[model samples]
Every structure is written in structure tokens, then in C-alpha cells.
Target: MLKLLFPILVMLGFAQLTPVSDFFTWDRNLILQGEVWRLITGNFTHTNLAHLIMNAAALMVFCFIFKDILNPKKLWGLLLSISLMTGGLLLLSPIQSYVGLSGVLHGLFIWAAIEDIKQQRSTGWLLLVGVVAKIAWEQYFGASASTISLINANVAIEAHLIGACCGAILQLLYYFYTLSTASDAPK
Candidate 1:
């Protein structure tokens, strides 16, 4: 709904304003030094306008595909969920810094694809396979060499993996919930 999307558009715009992104980008040592806000804000910031537009467009597509499910509050929760997973991956690794919403976009796509699966849509399986293939490609080839040209930065592929894993966990939780509720319903 416009109610949810309007705010996201606004937030994304806010992220692009000068001076704000510098304070928000994820920096490993900075985090270790206790600048904790980066954990959440980094995902909202971007390396450049192209990078922001790419990620924002992907986010819009995700929202449209899963609009039936991702209302404003739930969208915020999903962002938070994937942000933690991506942040944890960055924290545990030797990698010093990173930024972008692509990581969270992966999780959102995976989550939406799983929802498609629950509805028996073939697109679900296709999306799941495509996502896995993309991750595998990135892991093997390394940080999507091509993105360096587009975004002027290397990709943190691990973030994509972590987000996918988190999305799958969300789907698993829903699976168990459905099974439990179905069994509990009186005949």
C-alpha cells in the first residue's frame, strides 16, 4: 500500500542526503568500538546513486511481488530480520566494511519465493533455484566482479547467503505453525 511504500521511499531518499550515509556505513572496527547504529543504518545507505537505485528498484519489485504479505510494519520487521543476519555475518568475518540493501533484498526475495511455493506457484521453485545459483556463482567467482563496474565496489556475497538462510528459517517457522494449527483444529 502507498501508506507503507511512501515511508520507504522517503527513508531511501533520506539515506541519499549528504553527510548521513557517512555516519551509517558498516565498518568492522567502528562497530567493535561500539558505534552500534551502523548495524541497522548501513543497509539503508549506499556506495553511490547507481547502487542505491539498483537496490531500491529490487526492493520495489520485492514489495510488489509480496504486497499481499508485506504491510508497512511487517516490511520493517523483515528489514530488521535480514539486517541482523547480514550484520552478524559481517561482524564474524575479517571483512572490514560494507554497505548496500542487496543483502536484505535477497532475504526478501527468498521469503517471497517461499510464499509463492506455499501457494503452489512454479515461480517459487524457479526463484529459489535462481537465488541459490546466484549465491553459488558469487561465492565461487567472488563478490560479483561485474558489480565493481556498476557500483564501484565489490559485493559481500556472504551477506546474500545469510539473508537466504534467514528467509528459509522464516519459511520453516511458518511450515511448523501451519502443521500445528491444522492438527489442532477440531474435526
Candidate 2:
């Protein structure tokens, strides 16, 4: 696990560099101009140290909690899939730019929670409800004042919604795919 996490944390550290973040952040116009990699890179960048720490901590927690199921390949695949989906969906919103991992973290949490439920763990229900409620609160009211102050930017609540939805959709697709594959196996 340390092997898998070391490289990611290192990459996150590098992303904090001003020039790197400026280059990687999801800029609507830049993407339209053919800088498509921003879709993945932006999610790894951050507005500030506080934002990075908050997201890094969450990532660690989710990785720890879902260690049983999260191998490097699975983790990377989930991160990439959610990042791409969320970034693509963000194009439809009014947001011109974004940088942070919170959206991908939400998606990771949702995906792990769904996995927990598949394994018949009751905690999955709790996590799912908790995240949904949090998203709902953010959407209806707005991001917490403290978070906005800490991150030094207005939170993009739409990204949270899109990321969580992407997680659920991807997990469901995986579940069905496995089901069909199992059924096709010789008895």
C-alpha cells in the first residue's frame, strides 16, 4: 500500500507548484482549445496547502478504510474514470476553472461505500447517506463558510454531484459486468 501511495503523494506535492497547477487546472477555454489533459490533472492540483492537506487526508482515510479492495490498479482506474467523467460534466456548468481533489475524493468515497455494501457491510449505508446529505446541504445552501475560507475559493458543488454520480454509475456498470461474466462461466 505504501508503494502505491508514495508515488501519488509525491505527484500531489509537485502539483502544488504554481506553474504546474496553473498549467494543469481545469480551464474551460483551455480545454476547448484542445488542452484535454487538464481534465485529469486539475483534480490533482489544489488552490493552497490547506486544500491539499484536507484532500490528501481524505484520500488516505478512504484508502485505509477500503484497503481490502483497493489495489493500485483498481485505485488508479477509479481515480482516472471519475476525474474524466467529472471534468467532462463540468463543461456544462458555468464554472470557468477548477483545481482540487475534493470531487474525486467524493467519487472514491462513493465507490468504496458501494463496494462495502456489496460485501454486506452496514457501514456502507452510513457512508452513502452521509455523503448524499453533505452534497445535498452544499447544493441547497452552499459550501460551508469555513471550507471556502480555508480553501480560498468558492466550492464547486456541481463537481461533487457529478463525481458522486460518476462513482455510482461506474460501480453499477462494474457490478453488472461481473454478474454477466460469472453467469457465462461454466457450471
Candidate 3:
């Protein structure tokens, strides 16, 4: 968990130092201008302290749930895969610019929740139901209103959907791989 928090804390500090969010947000125009680094860095940036705090809380929730299951390698793999997939989907869509870790948090939550289900833990079903409900609510109602007007950012439902899908897909692959490996082991 420290492995994940270290970078997020660093990025939060970097975001505080950056006066212009455009420097860290995923902007289609700037990306077209070859500022491709935004694809990765944008995941770490937030609109304001409130936004950062919300994201950090969400990350902690997911990390705490998956702490025993996620080693450094699995954590890194999930982070990179989910973020890359989220970026790819954003680039193809009409989103002009975006910031915050909400999207990645959705992915992390889904991955951990599914891992719980695979282990026959009841919390998995509860988490899955909550996630599905949240996504559905977003789809029907647009972005949920944030009380933190200081941050003043719109939630990108597309990012959440893409991230969740990627996580679900990754978990499915992991499940199959585990099954195959177990079956192949000599009795």
C-alpha cells in the first residue's frame, strides 16, 4: 500500500505546486501538440485540495481492501493497464480535458471487489452492487453533484466505465490463468 501511496502523495504535492491545471490535465489539444506525458501524469493530478482529498480517500478504501492480495507487481500492473486503457478510451471520445483519480479509483475498486468474490467473500457482492448502482446513477443523472465547488470539476462517466470494464476484464483473465495453472499442476 505504501508503494501506491508514495506516488499519489508525490503527485498531490506536485499538483499543489502547479498553478495551471492544464499542465497536468489530459487535454486533447495539448496531447495532439505532443504533450503526451499528460496521459500518465493526469491520473495523479486533481483540480484542488478537495478533489485530491476525495481521491485519496477512495484510493485508501480500495488499497485497504486489497492489501493482502496486491503485491507490488500486481498493483503496478493493474495501475498501468487500467490507466492506459482509460487514456485510450478518453482519446477516442469527446472529452476535452479531465483531472482527478476518480476513474482509476473505480477500476481499483472493481478489481478488488471481484477478487473478493473470487475468494467467496460476501463483501465482493456488496461492493459489486454498490459500484453498479453508482455507475447506473451516473449514466442516468449525469455526474453526481459535488459539494466541493472549490474544485469545480465535472465527473467523466466514460472514464469510470472504461476503467471498470478494464478491471473486470483483467480479473477475468487472472481467474482463467489461475484455473489453468492449477489444473496443470501434477496431482
Candidate 4:
């Protein structure tokens, strides 16, 4: 939906500007110095045109695949929440700086796929398995050489892991919450 894509497109536009990109990268020292906006902004930043294009294309693919399953608000919420959680968790790792939407993408794909399953769409199972396997493989062997070369940075595998975990957990919590709310309604 344009509502969701608008913000992503705006972030992509901002990333194309050198000054904005520099100011928004997730830098630990800068964050320690109180530039906290980087925590959220960094997820929307990118290292190069290749990185931007790759993530943007992935976003479009996800939007097309899950469009019917996820309303724009729900999809945007998953993305923002996962981005924030992943960014915060990265601070606990050895990484001092990070950027790119891949982490949030992983989370969004996961959470949306689960929602698909809740709606009884069989494709959700395929997507869930595929993303879980991808994350698992990344954990075991590191990112693909082609991806590393394309992005020109050591992929933050930890971010991917954190994002996926957060996505699963959030979906679980939401499931429980909805169930409880429904149960509490008057008979």
C-alpha cells in the first residue's frame, strides 16, 4: 500500500543524500553521545546504491507477496517494532556500527508469514520455513560472499537473528493477546 511504501520511499530518498546518510548510520559512540535517533534511522540507511536497491527490491517483493494478508498498518507496525528491537539488541553485541533494512526485512517477512498462517493461507508455512532456514544458515556459515561483496560490509548476522526472534515472539504475544481479548468479550 502507498501508506507503507511512502515512508520506505522517503527513507530511501533520505539515504541517497550524503549528509543524511552520514548523520543516520548506527554508530555506538554517537549513540553514547546521545544521538539516539540513529537507533531507528540506521535501519533505513544503506551503505551503497547496491545495498539500497537490493533492500528496496526485497521490500517490494514482500509487499506483493503479503499484500492481501497484511493491512498496511499492521505491516508498518511489524517493521518499525522489529527495527527498533533489532537495533537495540545490536548494541549488546560486538558490532559498533550498522545499517541497512535487511534485519527489519527478516522480521517483517517472519511476522507477516505467521499472520498468513493464522489466516489459514498455506503459503505462510513455506515462507516461514524458508526464512528460518536462511537465518539458520547465516548463523552457521556467515553471509553469502556475493551479498558481502554487493553490500561492501560484513553482514550483521546478529541483527538478522535478533530480528527473526523478535518477530516470532511478537507474533506469539499478539496471538495470545487477541485470544485473551476475544475470550473476555461477553458471551
lDDT of model 1 at residue 61?
78
lDDT of 3 by residue, 68-137 (tens): 8977677777877777777667898789887877777788888888888979999999999898788888
CA deviation > 4 Å runs, candidate 3: 1-4, 19-21, 147-150, 176-187
lDDT of 2: 0.92
lDDT of 2 by residue, 1-187 (tens): 7876777888999999999998999999999999999998999999999999999888888888888898889888999999999999899999999998888889999988888898999999999999999999999999999999999999989999889998998989998999999999999
The residue-by-residue lDDT of candidate 4 on 1-187, one tens digit each, is: 7776777777787876899989989898898899988887888889898999999999988887877766767877877788888888889989999999988888888888888898898989999999999999999999999999999999989988888888888999988999999999999
TM-score of each: 0.88, 0.96, 0.85, 0.92
- Whose lDDT is higher: candidate 2's or candidate 3's? 2
Higher-TM-score candidate of 1 and 3: 1
- After aligning candidate 3 to the native by TM-score, how far in Å is the CA of 3 from where it should be? 5.5
What's the TM for model 2?
0.96
- Of candidate 2, the 10-residue stretch with the lowest lDDT total is 1-10
How many clashes in each structure?
0, 0, 0, 0
Of candidate 1, the 10-residue stretch with the lowest lDDT total is 86-95
Candidates ranked by lDDT, best first?
2, 4, 1, 3
lDDT: which candidate is best? 2
Q: Candidate 1: give its CA RMSD in angstroms.
A: 2.2
